[model samples]
Target: MKFVASLSAAAAALGALAMLPTTSAHGPETREEVVKFLDQQATAYHCAPAVAAYTAARKRSWAQKVLGGAPIADQNRFIDGYFEAKGLDGEVVKKGIKELEEEGKRIMACDPVVESKIRNSTCVLAPQSTEGPYYHTEAHPIRSNMAEWQLGLHFEMDVGVIDVETCEPVPNILVDLWHANATGHYAGHPEPAPHLRDEKPAASGLRRGLLSAYPRTNHVDTFLRGALPTDQNGVAHFVSTFPGYYTGRATHVHIKVHNEWSVLPNGSFTSGNLVHTGQFFFDDDLNESIDKLWPYNTNPIIALGRTRTRNWEDSLQIYQDAHDNGYMPTFDVEKIGGVLQDGLVGYITVGVNTSASYKPVWNPNSGRAGGVVEQKPIDKATHEEL
Candidate 1:
């Protein structure tokens, strides 16, 4: 039997709402009014474009374990309302319903394909160390509060001519990405210690004098925002360090991809608008080292040593042969369980469009006090909505 990961009908519904008319003064309608309209549309199409069967399976498992019973109906209602509020109703709802039905039938018709487990052969045998103008210096203002050095890895996935419905590679897909820094820190304009200098006494490690403003060097803005072009083989490479793990969440990067059809309001192409959010994991040793420290130690998702590297290989140098002219590392997409493993590896193939199959696997606070998941509700208290 062929196994196919289900696509979220909510996504299709939301996509449709993006084409709807909004309310404005003499214009269409207010944001709230437009939101209400979409909600009604989504309600009308609720059952038609319900959540994917695969997603429902995972949720079913969780509900049974945690809720002691399957709240499938309640969950569906909540999801539908959430999508509706996001303005994904009407045409989008109809389209999503069709897509869901087609996907369900495909899964039911074929046996699932079993994927072979791949090994994470990459490792930082000798961790590279670099010195920075420490302690709020003019050049490197941010003081390192964490004991260990942190790294962040970013990925760009290219879905080469593979229609999700047909399971074939579609050429010329674009992926966009952004993420936090190694120290779980973010870099922004007018750095925190703009006035600090790097002339502190090394022996005493004490703050020296008023920091001087030096010309910014290596200002690549690694904090976030970058896109990569895929190769003929339908893969894109990113030169990034392993991202540090934080409290509550495991170590991972953020990524998104866009097809040719996705466009902006001005009829221009937008990058990474497909919206796929996923977290990547590292090897057992590195994870263990990270867990020994704070934040990650307390994080529930930081499962150390539980995940082992199946086929371990080391010392695969990138600059070994004359043909190696600083090309990006390469790995088989079918191998590594559809996710990038951690460490400074030269090449990785976590599978293109892995995020495309991604679904909300876990929700820490599903039915807690003051916890609610709406389609895209604006936080009235914060005046922020996503």
Candidate 2:
């Protein structure tokens, strides 16, 4: 909306906003201060129209559906049109590209061995991304009704997979998705009357996240968690509600990519390749709107206290880190607009290796690798895993 003001003037305005005074370390502490701060973020980030972003996202979604794993440029054509049509700020675009370039160079210069190990593992794919705080590989990995949470903004995403080795689209890859509900509670993580998992939104004054202090009943009721395979064009679509944020993280969606995964005779996932893992990000401006919405705002932290859900900064940093290590930032999430209710579409291309033979290492009590990442020896000269 206001953020997308005439692009011709956006360069000057972003320059001005960049020079604005920074907020204190943790962010606005009081409710009134939080509101004022978020309002400022909305203005500064140039909140785009939910309709425009959603529409652009929707068109891109359809294109992905029909074209499947089409080249990124094809999808960008549609995305760029949306930004152009909405008159997106040139400064935002310019700054994003510049940052990407610098990050790219940095990643390219990392130790080849370390970069190899990183890229071979989920850590390198999605910019400091991890797996198994809560993941269901057995029962509900391919589900689509994740929106059953029944609260907060509705969200859907279309993921495109590219084979970095071949520079081509990869099809039939299984994509796993999960995130916290509007209350910052993830499905299967445990909630006694979980919907009422914590303070009533009206009560205010609660703002913790998925830290160990929270219960993990593992109810496995299966909301906001599922998996789908990419079509011929390397695209997998999902249905979900906008995620709620917790302490130390922004609003995000965790995605895992599995190659050679297939539905067995009973329709359960059998083969697993655990190729990629990363999180999708949202526009800071639109997040301000989510802060004021029901349930999401009700998360004790936001309703009663402060907002732990910082915006794009952390994701950008992680992306930079991954790029420095010579890998892509999981995927590129093209945001269409800010309105959370009408729903928006997200698109990203994840690069995966079809020939990877690494076994996943999970969180072993002894600090051993157990999940998607494996412990490997690093060569100092190359700072790479040998």
Best by TM-score: 2
Task: Please provide, for model 1 over 34-73, each residue's C-alpha lDDT reduced to its tens digit, 9 standing for 90 to 100.
Answer: 3343332232222212223222332333335434664433
TM-score of 2: 0.57
Cα lDDT computed for each candidate against the true fold: 0.29, 0.49
TM-score of each: 0.31, 0.57
Candidate 1's C-alpha runs over 4 A off are: 1-115, 118-162, 189-224, 261-269, 272-275, 283-285, 290-343, 346-386
Instruction: State the lDDT of candidate 2 residue by residue for 231-337, as single tens digits.
Output: 65556778788788765456677777766466766455764556666666555556677778887767867545665655433422332233323333322333333
Residue 140, candidate 1: alpha-carbon lDDT: 20
Which candidate number would show the highest lDDT if scored against the true structure? 2
